[model samples]
Target: MKEIPKKNGFTTPPGYFEGLSERVLNKLEEKDTSALPSKEGFKIPEGYFDGLEEKIQDKTLQRETKVFTLKPFRPFLYAAAAIAVLVVLIIGLEKNNTSTPTFDDLAQAEITQYIESRDLELSSYELAEVLPVSELEIGDFMESSVDQDEILDYLEDSIDDLDELNIETHEEYQ
Candidate 1:
């Protein structure tokens, strides 16, 4: 068995490439010299170029301009904002106005217990000073339900000598 050598099957004649470029140029020149019109039937109308700039400007100016505004919705927006504020205020007031206990609502025993538990260092004079003088009346103190015997007993137990007591009478005021 013999091995065949690989060879290109296509071949060109001698000097084919050397004359290729010259042949192509000659064909182009022949086409150029033929009796065909250069414009190939496409023609621009007269005065078309003269008015092109003005025509473009006129077309641009004739286009309607788009305008956007919030003017129509201004009142609605303001109303919505005001409604939001009112709603917020209403909710806030509802929360704040919930039934909070006032000093008058507390029982006397509860008030006394609270004062005793806190061990406040304030004296009776200091407590009296804090009370508004305008609100106090002689009946407020005199109207207490304590028995006169109990008062005498408490005073006797608290005081060693009656001579030290500075009792004031209504006659002394005159």
Candidate 2:
């Protein structure tokens, strides 16, 4: 076949195609328009490729969001961790409280020693004056009181008897 001169983009031979025999031209036209085997071997499902592309784009967006969203909660996480550590230390130390003496317990022990001592001179001035009171008078009134055992009991019993006997009767009611 003679080569064709290109006009615009077609590379057909100029008068050669025009002078082509009818049967050859017809056969050439038929072959040109005939469909080749479909490219179905490499084909994917219709919307699968588009969905995959969308999924990729969504994953990229999610990654970007995660990268940018981390800063604000970092301080809170650190504070919570610090608080947890402090709580653990406090709980560990609190477990040993029974071994440690509280101020109130020490005071109570000291007061008891002062109260039970033989020598009144060794007692505090406050306890020394009240030491002469008898044990029987100390029990009924100050049974539950820790600090003042003797004088408080005597005074409390006296006050209760006085309160019971001093009741006033209204003349109108009588």
lDDT (Cα, tens digit) per residue for candidate 2, span 66-144: 4455556468888999999999999988997757666546654576676578565554667646554454365444657
TM-score top scorer: 1
| Residue lDDT tens for model 1, 37-67 | 6666877889889989998999788677787
Q: Find the candidate with the highest lDDT and give its number.
A: 1
lDDT of each: 0.78, 0.65
Candidate 1: which pairs clash?
none
Cα TM-score per model: 0.30, 0.19
- lDDT for model 2 comes to 0.65
User: After aligning candidate 1 to the native by TM-score, how far in Å is the CA of 157 from where it should be?
Assistant: 52
